[model samples]
Target: MISASSQQKKQLQKYTMLEGERKQGQFPLLEMSHLLYGGKDQFDKFLERQNFFDTNPMFKVNHDFYNKSRQDQILLNAERTVEAMKKLSLGDPNYYTPNVLCPQGIFISTVHFAMVIPAFQVLASDDQITKWMTSLKNFSAIGCYAQTELGHGSDVQNLQTVAVFDKQTTEFVIHTPNIEATKFWPGELGLYCEFALVFAQLQVDGKGYGVHPFWIRIRDKETHKPLSGIEIGDIGPKMGYAVKDNGFMSFDHFRAPLDSLLNRYIKVSRDGKVERQGNPKVGYGSMMYMRNILCDQYTKFGGRALTIAVRYSLYRKQFKDDNKQEIRILDYQLQQQKLFPLLAEFYACVFGSIKIKELVNDNFNRISQSNDFSLLGLTHAVLSGAKANYTYFVSNCAEWCRLSCGGHGFAHYSGLPIIFFEMSPNITLEGENTILNLQLARYLLKQLQHIVSKPSAVPEFFKFLSLETVKVDDVTTIDNLIKLLGLNCAILTKYAAQKLMTHSDMKESWDTKSGIALAKAASTFIPYFNMLCFLDTINNKAKETKEILTILARIYGITMLLNNMQGLLLKNQLNSQQIKTLQDTRESLYPIIRTNALCLVEAQGLSDNSLQSLIAPKEGDVYMNMYNFASKENSLNKQQVHNGINYIQKMREVNAKL
Candidate 1:
């Protein structure tokens, strides 16, 4: 059972200014507790569940059943989590939300929900869905996603596994031609997954097509051992997600019927003619779908870190004041400076995530009914860029949150370390950030080229891009700042896109000859996309908020523009004085942001319970909980070893001298 002290310790809460003072409003500790529990219980009943941490029915089942039984249990837990996901949808009024469950839990519970079920739901034929969907939903059968290969993870077009169709047997023989073709890095694949949504090169009648997912059995039904022609094993420890059974597999002439191909979107006939529905890119829609959800997922990622950091900040105290009272570290300008900007970013990401979700849902609805999918390609392109930007920014800020808390920040108890570990993997997972940014660059280029070919094709947003030169000559005002931000992004969007098109025919412009060249192209384009993202946020802020946000938007834009300031100077587009003015304008914006540091953080609707760190919580009796925690027997036991050994050695030396 949970001790009273432990229960009291975790009854962490915060209060904020009223809604008139802040947009997202303030959730009191009681309200937050309600929000967390979906209105079922008060503090007393909530603590009761905390007692069963080691053997909670839900928690234990995930480990004992899913982690141990491996394949079958993986599917089981996935189905449970899928049910949980439906319960936890934002649209639901009474969702039982946990504290954002950490990466280990998120991966263990969500891999199947997010990766496997969706692949089958979107890809499988009606008959296949009839056969498998219910079993998948009920957890009688389990599935894992298998697309990333050991050698070619992000490059979808270059995977080496082959599924050649046999006319006589009417089966597709799945084969791993070499060790490099081995499927790797699929979560829960080694032990937990019974079947896999396998992506492999499709060859029929001597004609080859690119990768596609085929549902294939991976383990025996009764024995639970690897099936014939299959080799499966763990990929060993990774930096994060230790509990997740991320694993590797190789197929040796595995056989499945011709009907195994997920034919909802794409189909291979006996004659080898390939028929596809709507857009060919729709076949690769899982990645696109995940990328869309990642915006909100990443916001929560940063919010969790911010929660830890903010709470810790409130709870940590440094030097005593003149009255000999300790001051909270959050009071220090340097501390606020280090963390508040990131706090604002967390808020921006939250709002941005909401927007993206709306966009994705609306577009999906349109595509479903009208079959007009012009937005699918655009949504995919926009989201891939935005996801990369937000994840990277949030991950970087999480590290800074670590530094802000000093020594305790490094401790696992502080929670920043885990948050960082969880978030850092995102830079590479869905799509490598750099390569994905370049994909957005292609979209931008496509738009610019269309407008150039037909001047009437230009979006009104691109009118600034059409200008031969963009000028920043106006006097300073908040309204002007906001306008300039939008204008700046439009110009950059037009310029970069047009530049790529003008240079597209030159082989040297698209050179992958060196890492430096490749990185330059990626770096140049992502900032343009990020600028647009920031301006998009700036446009939505309330008047007073927008005034401040405009400053931040200007700083963000000017920072990118300054990277090529020399080019701007050489081309006579910017005088030295103008560059200095922009720098001064950016430097000035930081202080205006600094004054409202506490209010800004609170406005994000963040609570001390949410942040769960030393540096970011509500201003309070800082260090009381931390000191109590530090003074605990278990916590002290960890530090006791070195102190105890030193004392013993000292005593022995003194006795010998006597």
Candidate 2:
């Protein structure tokens, strides 16, 4: 372990911690990631591939082929990106973001892997899967998730693009008959993908049957040219994700073989009978699945920022004593206030993400085996809302971390600008947060209606919203605090659910009025969920570990209760004295936690390499090396320059002249 003896050495060690530690299992702060996600085989091979892909061939392929002639580049990059993907062994889940960003065109296709593929797996007929799945996986062809159109994105039922049946050839003729019908915001359609899973109005024998995904090849695989009757190109730049080339496309009369339709859940027979295997919403399963993975994605972004900020804060020095000795920025309470909450948040997010991943996997398994979709459907709404909320919150936190570093934070070298830029698009992608939150509201409303009809069907968690009772445990241990917080989270959801049910017709109006509050209510689950994870870990461990975890539990609950004061007040959940007790407990826990901050961050399992800060050291080096670097760099001399009368008098003279 690096020495923490000198302030200067400690500062220099901060940034170096994230550099290569992810590969070493030294940074993620979690002790049980191996058990939760998989073994070292899962993580190590991924790191190896990340290194390979970040190097020459992939870089050249992305830069020369994808960035140069974006129109033509799109087609080429699609092939190249697929080729790279084919090289992966698929033995492990490879989740590394390349050190360099892929062009938006490519990021779009990559995201499609997360956003759309699961739906195809679940929704496509066996034959349909057999014909395309292998090639799709092997990258013989590239595809896009084309659901959102210029005319209507969130409202799936009202899409303008139509896929009409041509009974004569047993084919589907896809057409964007109007300007609005043109597919918009598809990632690779402008240039890369040869095929797309077009979400079009499935018109069978002149009757519209809402939106359905049809796999249609848009380009010739051999010649790399757009197929007959297809128009696609870039949609131009936006606030972020410039590297991802979001593109627009339209079809004049594109034709596909009859079996091209993804007919897993809902299908049209050769005779034009619309046979339903399941609810159409099941088609949304893949999207919801991506939203779940995005929970981890958000945590990653937040964790990376925290890693940088923590190290940078340690390295950066400000005001000095009369002896002119510089002090680490982290020594200040103001800096602590700005960053420690986020530091705590980083830990919270990792645990929360693991929990969400477990939930996702459980739901996927249950849905895969039993095909009983009630839980899947509920999770779809709830998970998406949770993902949207947590990701947005983390993004904001990361940017604030950047800002807290002042000028150095804006520098790309500090890792904040790219981090900030990279995180912004998460708010709109997969599904816009506003629209997704409404989906949650809708789901909650449905649950409320179910409870009204059959009270026994409601989960115990929703009992608070039942209007009939208020029954929580009389005990108030830390465990109970966690439990009550869980109950509080469920109650908040139920409250919103009941209102949504009571004013079902006013969903849009209520969404407009109470949307932010509803989002807040949805997000309340994160801290509550986080507290449970920590407590669960504690309860499973030795006594001393439990004691340490108890402090975090108190901190987590008290912090949350303070934030949601309105809920506590409106629901009469806690008395005034209890609220004060929570606050007092929180204050008492702060110093106890402060001493353990570095140890806590270490337990998160994030690598020093990924942190990209010099001050936060790895296993080998910490404060001594940083102090040496700082002393040798002569930062104290620079401080003397600032204090020198010559420099000060020059500055004063200039100011007086001005």
Candidate 3:
């Protein structure tokens, strides 16, 4: 048998070989990075930030970092987050990337940066901005967006938290009437945030005016103590994101000045007369912004996980080939089957995210200027569908990457487990994926009704619904493939609508019975959008890059079809022969993609510091790097015997006495 020293030496050799393989690719890594980052300047800026983090010990991922107690982790995260903000001058407009504030993963300051601050910017009136925005920017009063209550997560209409307007004091009395009304799972509210953008049902003169956002102080800004009549504390350790102080809050009888109401789209006078302005849907802007952010965040999660998995697969050697030489596990057909398609999906998500973000920004600007709510419905539907789809895809991809790595993936140093845990909440947060998808289905059904009534009046996005049927022969071409997917989407939507219509005019009962069908219908639109964005990107690319992206796009399309083949088969959209053809096409593309897999992942331009995976070392010193890092950073390594040993000894003595 080979000794431990021999095994170590062999692993080093494999690492070196894998490093050599990565360098043998034909495409230029820098050029791909430029493409991925949007431009050379953006790539440079990303590199600069990455280099800074690389040298900062505070950002390092030590083994003990993952093993820390929840309280310690939260405290450390809060300190590091503040220090990062200061050192990086994070509030500067030039340095603002959604990620600059929460560099590694979810941080204590995420809800403040992504939700609270953005909500204030978009929904707060000019006067309110002037009074509170500066303090928020300066971190004088940290804030959380407290929207989800224990009983009402996605169903905002039923939120029990009440805000009654007191015409006498010109104040809003916010009260949590019961346990279910307590605000739950607002990041930073548990420990750090001084204030919150609380969503409560507004009661004016004993009449309900739906849920509205009101700014309320939850804790004292000076002492970081819970304010009088406010009860707040951390909700204990979660599956992941232990550092984030996701907390619960309840107000006994909190009073806020009338000006605390975000009155950009709605206003109320001191006399208690409520005046609604702009579109009522505009109140969803903050939630929409977070959903948009989630689309991009999913790309990041998938990219990082793929980077680690792909790199490790290239280094791990298992069975010997016919030549009696052990080949890298990456050469196995099964491994490629698991990872390559995901790599393509990751790219699709990247492009799709950029498209959705641009769409949202344009719509937001239009709303601010003209209050043209024409595109608001479409934007909401698209974002809701995309967010739900992408989060589910990325979360599943992360788990698959972990499983693909075999035993090492189980170790915390592998980085996959943390990613899996951290991102798991994404499916439930913002909006539950199932509920969000149903919302999209509802939108699609509306559009379908319009199409049926007047095909010419259908919006540009749904115009394809009136097109000619896709022939089986056309499935080989990308455009035809897209048409086929679109056809599937239309069919699914129609089927879901039919199912809903069967409920005998009871809308609530229809929604309840058609939930599964509606979710499935909405999910079909995601790949269609992804493919549309991906095709647009490839069409705009130069010839060389276009060729590579075409291959990736094909892989993505085929993989999506295979994954959803059962639905397509049931709908008669694809036949057995076509399914076989898709399988064959997927098989044919694997080897070609395997040649460029390393280069493709490298193009994402993720830094070693950002990845924080020992298995994905920059220099490809995979085994030794993991060994040394684990040895140095694991707190248990420093101890000769752990406390568990004494417990075992005591149990043995009791058994002997018995």
Q: Using lDDT, give the best candidate's number.
A: 3
Ranking by lDDT: 3, 2, 1
Candidate 1 vs 2: which has more lDDT = 2
lDDT of each: 0.62, 0.64, 0.81
lDDT of 2 by residue, 542-623 (tens): 4545566666666666666677645555667777777777766665556655555555555434544444443344543444
lDDT of 1 by residue, 421-492 (tens): 767888888888878877765665566567668766654434333444445574234334334444444455
Candidate that would win on TM-score: 3
Candidate 2 regions with alpha-carbon error over 4 angstroms: 1-87, 90-92, 96-109, 269-271, 279-281, 321-324, 445-455, 460-477, 483-520, 542-545, 575-581, 604-609, 612-658
- Models, CA RMSD each: 7.7, 8.0, 2.6
TM-score of each: 0.76, 0.78, 0.94
Better of 2 and 3 by lDDT: 3
Candidate 1 off by > 4 Å: 1-101, 270-278, 314-333, 460-464, 473-508, 513-595, 603-610, 614-624, 627-658
The digit string of per-residue lDDT tens for model 3 on 127-197 reads 98999888888778789999999998889899999999999999999999999999999888887888899
The 10-residue segment of model 1 with minimum total lDDT is 90-99
- Weakest lDDT window of 10 consecutive positions for candidate 2: 61-70
- Cα lDDT, model 2, residue 551: 66
The model with the greater TM-score, 2 or 3, is 3
Q: Report the poorest 10 consecutive residues by lDDT, candidate 3.
A: 93-102
